[model samples]
Target chain A: MRVLGIDPGLTRCGLGVVDGALGRRLSFVTAGAVRTSSDWELSERLLGIERGVQSWLDEYCPDAVAVERVFAQHNVSTVMGTAQASAVAITCAARGGLPVASYTPSEVKAAVTGSGRAEKQQVQAMVARLLALEAAPKPADAADAAALAMCHIWRGGAQDRIARAQQEFHRKAGTARRARGV
Target chain B: MRVLGIDPGLTRCGLGVVDGALGRRLSFVTAGAVRTSSDWELSERLLGIERGVQSWLDEYCPDAVAVERVFAQHNVSTVMGTAQASAVAITCAARGGLPVASYTPSEVKAAVTGSGRAEKQQVQAMVARLLALEAAPKPADAADAAALAMCHIWRGGAQDRIARAQQEFHRKAGTARRARGV
Candidate 1:
């Protein structure tokens, strides 16, 4: 299955396309960063990110989309932007009816490097080795996206099933609540 | 001029439309909340929000959009969702070519109640009084939205001009940076 991974940020959003499934050799399709001007309003910058992600989705048509999950524990100033940018990508993917998953940085590193606490260079080297690339994708964000895509392919099966089950359960409960007119 | 105000939240996004420009008799167009099921995934909830906001924008056709500026200092568990939801609305507004402005709770309260520390009930009362409504809009979220729209109308002139000026400056700077091929 083909997967698109995103390392979301307001100023620089990374996109990586990988074609593979569990137990299959992964092939790199493309990797790059979508950069937006920090000078722009948050709304405008978000619009730019939306357009960039849309263009990638249209071009790659990946079977699933993976985004880096953001936490509130990071730098106070940048965490909000990271969350906002991640939201744009996630919502856009949902709008297109694609299944989406999010992975923490350590999850991606662990999936690709076999160590949760792997260093950045170690993850990069492993990603390059796994995809048979001469070197890891330039732009650290792109490499991070590649790692996320690989993680989804390796660990996403169980994660996606759990995610869907939770969504389905919530939907049913919501319907029941609405039917009771609450 | 008409303004569409949004109080962004994942579970409930408040929307209010008001008619009037600065120094004019303000009229209420509508006030309501767009509720989403908490059971859905973040992306799904966000997509729901996007659709709800889009429907309001299509029906209202406001000259500008006003949204609450979210801060990361609030409840840790919900602040990220708030930021994400706010991004969806702001991005949707920008995509539709609507000018969008964000005001903090204090700014809205100060604009409507003459005090930033005014109680929520006081702000609601002022909104009802300013709009000549029989009572404050039901559901506190909707009232907050109306107050936001009214705030935009009463204090939006200078704010909008400054926002536009900043955007223009950013656009120009961005162009110069690109021209320099940096």
Candidate 2:
């Protein structure tokens, strides 16, 4: 499955797409940052982000979108902007009828580096290693976004598989009951 | 000028339109809440808000939009939703090229009730009095939305006039200087 991960911020929104399925080799598709001007008004900046996310979705066309869930407790000043940006990204994906998922920063770090308290550099290095890239994705935002996508593939993908398996099992059981006229 | 006010929330986004200008008799255009189902997904709820705000803008055709500025410092549990909803509303207005303004909750309360620390009922009471309505706008969110529009008409409206005046003064001064051949 192809997943697009978003590390949302007003000043710089990270967009990354990774292609993989559960227990499959992951490959990098694309990674970039949509940077908005600091001097622009709040609405204009948000509009820029909205358009940027739209363009990213148009170009990459990922199966699902994963965003980093924002918390109000941390980063008192930037949390609002981050929340706003994430809203734009998630809303855009949803408008396109794609499933949207969000993982906390710790959840992403733990998934990527096996440590919720992993350092940024450690996560970056692991991302590079996981994707078999010569270098970590440039700019921390893009790397974080890539990590989010990977996390979703590992966690959400497993859930998807389990759900499909349950449906198949139920279908088989129903067929067996019909054959026995029960 | 006609102004649309939004008290943005994920579950129930308030939308209100008020007609008036600086120092003019403010009248209510319309007020309502865009209620979304809690059972809906986050992105689905946001999409519902987007469509609701768009329909309001389409029908009301307001000259500008006023939204309550969300702060991360307050309502930790609900602030994220508020911020996301505000972003959706502000972005919708911006996309339509309508001027968007935000006022803090205190600003709205103070502008409507003469005190920033005024109670909700007090603000609601003053909103009814200011609009000359027989009753306050039903649903606290809608009432708050109206108050936001009133606040913009009082404060942002003045700033807008000053800006227009400055531009007019500049134009006249330029003409005078040209005519004087200085």
Candidate 3:
């Protein structure tokens, strides 16, 4: 399965696409960033991001999309902008009929470097080695996006299956209880 | 001029439209809420909001759009969701080529009730009286939206003119300074 991962931001949004499935070797397809000027109006910046990401989705046509989940930051404006960007990505993916998943920064690090506390350099290095690239992707945001894509390829499918199974189990259990009328 | 006001939320987004220009008596156009199910996926919920807001823009074609600016909340998820919805509203307005403005809750209250610390009932009562309606709009969200539209009608035009004048002044000053070879 192919997956597209996005590190959503207002000024700089990173995107990476990977081709792979569970228990299979992953290959990098593309990695890049969409940048918007701070001088522009907020709506203009958002529209720029929307157009850029939409173009990427149209080009890559990934089976699924993964985005960095935004959490609280010390700066309220920064966090709000990040969340807004993240939402745009999610909406775009849904519009394209692609399943969307979100991973925290630590989750991406853990999946790529086997340590949730891994440093940025460690995560970048591992992403390079895992993808068999001679060098890490330039710019931390690009490398982070590549790592996120890799993490989703490695973890998302299995996690989704497990969740489906759990849901089915619960549904069956409820039906059985209702049949027994207890 | 007509203004569309949005009270952004994940589950229930309130939208209000009003017809008026600065220094003119305002008249109510419409007020309603866009709701999404919590049972839906995050992307689905966001998509619903996007479609709903976009349809409103298409139908109303307001001169400008106003959204309630979100503030930090004790619940991270709730705040993030709100910010996301706000972004969607802004995006729709921008896509429609309508200038967008945001106001804080206190600002809306102050504009409608003459007090930033006014209670919800006071704001609703004031909005009903100002709109010449027999009853306040149903649901606090709808009333808040109407109040926000009224606020923008009363405040946004003057604010925009002042901002434009300031920009023009700075531009002229820069040109004069450049002519002096400074």
Candidate 4:
């Protein structure tokens, strides 16, 4: 299973794609941002991000997508921007036909560094070590996205177990039905 | 000034455009939603919304944009979707070159119905009366968008005051600079 992880932002969204079944097999598919002039209208900027996300979705065709979740903030402006980033990511995932999962900052940190309160540098260093990369992902946000993808893989495996259990239950039930009929 | 209000959503985004200036005539211009099939990919649906928003922005050239602020939610999935909506609205405003303003749900309701605890129907009723419409805007989300826009106009006037003050300050400084001749 291919998993795509995204760190969404209005100005920049960092994305990482990885092979879900094989641990530590990650390729830095893309890392950059979609920027618009300050003078440009909001719609134009949104469209730019949409286009960029579409391109990625089309190219990657990942089985699943993961994103960062936002918490409440006191600054109205900051909260608003963060909310927008979350929306853009969701929209992209929805469009890509990929099931979307969101991981909170703490959860992502814990998954990557074994501690929810791990510092950014610590998380970055651990992410590099886990993925066996040349260097830590820059801008923090990108690294966080990559880590989120890893968390999803871990979580996703649990989901698979649940699915398998359900299937087994159904199979037994079907056998019981045939036995009763006989 | 014409203002467009957006209630961003992953499945459906409610949009309303109003034509009028503060303390003057106000009229509804257009209101509707950009919707996509849930069965389709999430990213593709986002692209549809982006295209729709871009067309609206290009056609209307709204002076400002207003969106609902995200409130805390107990349901993680709902919260995630709400964040995505907020981000899409903000990005739309940024791309359109329109000043973006956000209002809490209470603020929008209070502005429309004179009570923060007013129900959705009450707020919609008040909006219809305020805009002198024969009927409430269809789909509660659309009415909510309109209410958000109304609140922005009510509060955004404060921004105008700030702008005027800054312009006056610059004018005074320029005059002083001329006198100094240094």
Q: Which candidate is the best by lDDT?
A: 2
The interface RMSD value for candidate 3 stands at 1.6
User: Model 2, which residues run further than 4 Å from truth?
Assistant: B180-182
The 10 consecutive residues of candidate 4 chain B with the worst lDDT sum are B72-81
The first chain of model 3 has a TM-score of 0.88
Q: After superposition, how far is residue A112 of candidate 4 from its true place, in Å?
A: 8.7
Candidate 3 chain A: 10-residue stretch with minimal lDDT: A69-78
What lDDT tens digits, residue by residue, belong to model 3 across residues A1-182? 88889999999999988898778888988898999999998889888889889999999899999999888864776898898888888898998899999999999999989999999889989989988898777777778988888888888988877899999999999999999995
The candidate that wins on TM-score is: 2
Cα distance off (Å), candidate 3, residue B71: 1.8
Chain A only: give the TM-score of model 4: 0.84
Flag regions of model 3 displaced more than 4 Å: A73-75, A160-182, B73-75, B161-182
Total backbone collisions for each predicted model:
0, 0, 0, 28
lDDT of each: 0.92, 0.93, 0.89, 0.73
Q: Write the per-residue lDDT of candidate 2 for residues A56-94, one digit (tens) a residue.
A: 999988999999999888888999999999998888999
- Which candidate order results from sorting by DockQ in descending order? 2, 1, 3, 4
DockQ of 3: 0.57
Candidate 4 matches the true fold with a TM-score of 0.65
Model 2 clash pairs are none
- Between candidates 1 and 4, which one is better according to lDDT? 1
What DockQ does each candidate score versus the true complex, computed on alpha carbons?
0.60, 0.86, 0.57, 0.31
lDDT of 4: 0.73
Kindly give the stretch of ten consecutive residues in candidate 2 chain B with the minimal lDDT sum: B15-24
